[model samples]
Target: MHDIAPYLLQNDLGGESLVEFEHEEGWDLIVVNLARAIDRHVRHQAKIDPESYDLDLIYFSQVKEKKGSLRAYVTMPDAIINAYVDFAELMSETTCEVTGRPGLLHTKMGFVKTLHPDVAAERGFKPVD
Candidate 1:
């Protein structure tokens, strides 16, 4: 079975350390869930009356009204593109590189899931297929 990384669903980095190579400029954050990117979310804006409200209230209200963000899309690595196509017989939900833990698909925000070579092997995943 494919092994997902611990805290793959968490808001933080979970347990994995950041890798320098994985760090892309302007993308300091990694997305934790690929589903979140694919999931439909409505973009919204808030109307505020600054003159009628305190600074803190206006700030907090704006924060609460914010919606989820999309994942950063970058070119996939050769190994990862081949791996996902080979193992799942479909395009990957995201791309990733190895860190302290096993390599995993990710967004700029965080990890979505771990890619275990053993799982691919057991499933007879071929690069071409």
Candidate 2:
């Protein structure tokens, strides 16, 4: 997986705490795609009016997998950026976090994860009831 931090313009690493990705490797592609979209969006807005969508106005504070879906904690406030995050979360729920294959939520014991059927079988996970 490629390092996504470089794509983020203002990740706000100085004041608070360092942001990090806590999801699986397969989801790295999803994050990369999202980062590019946000970068492009910010750049476009900067062209129109620099203050309209400044880079520092939004960024992910935390990214993690929870309950067979992606959870992104973004800082600052921006509706467009929030919508991008929402779409990414939806993609993560249907894509395997380990293999990037189309997937569904499965369970092993009490732990739930989004995984393809073959991968789930290999991991001893059962279909969610």
Candidate 3:
């Protein structure tokens, strides 16, 4: 897992060991996207109300059965959970599990359904046919 401790410390999230996993081929991009999403959410919230949305606590748990699956546990005062989930869903769509394809066309829905069913319902997410 590239030692998420450094990243967390750099972001001032404290040095709390969250989870560990083997580093996969394309997992770096996924993590980058997730961090971006969370950072964006935090910045936006800070703009709205600096005092209330000051702290953001999020942790990731690696799902052993699923190769590239990372479950996020968020503990923020605001409703930014959906934002993180949405970014995860988006990353899942872009990542390809098989040969020379642009996207994971077959497993997109199943991924979102399994990981973030509530997000799917909230965003009216459906298969891109």
- Every candidate's lDDT: 0.24, 0.78, 0.45
Using TM-score as the measure, the top candidate is: 2
Point out the higher-scoring one by lDDT: 1 or 2: 2
Q: Write the per-residue lDDT of candidate 3 for residues 16-124, one digit (tens) a residue.
A: 4545533344445566566566666666776998876564343443312153343444445245656665566456555532221234332243543222333334445
User: Against the true structure, whose lDDT is highest?
Assistant: 2
Sort order, TM-score high to low: 2, 3, 1
User: Which of 1 and 3 is the better model by lDDT?
Assistant: 3
For model 2, residues 40-103, the per-residue Cα lDDT tens digits are 7777777998876655556677888999988877665478878988899999989998899899
When sorted by lDDT, best at the front, the candidate numbers are 2, 3, 1
Error of 2 at 53 (Å): 2.9
Q: Cα deviation in Å at residue 99, candidate 2?
A: 0.4
TM-score for predicted model 1 compared with the true structure: 0.19
Candidate 1: Cα lDDT at 36: 27
lDDT of 1: 0.24
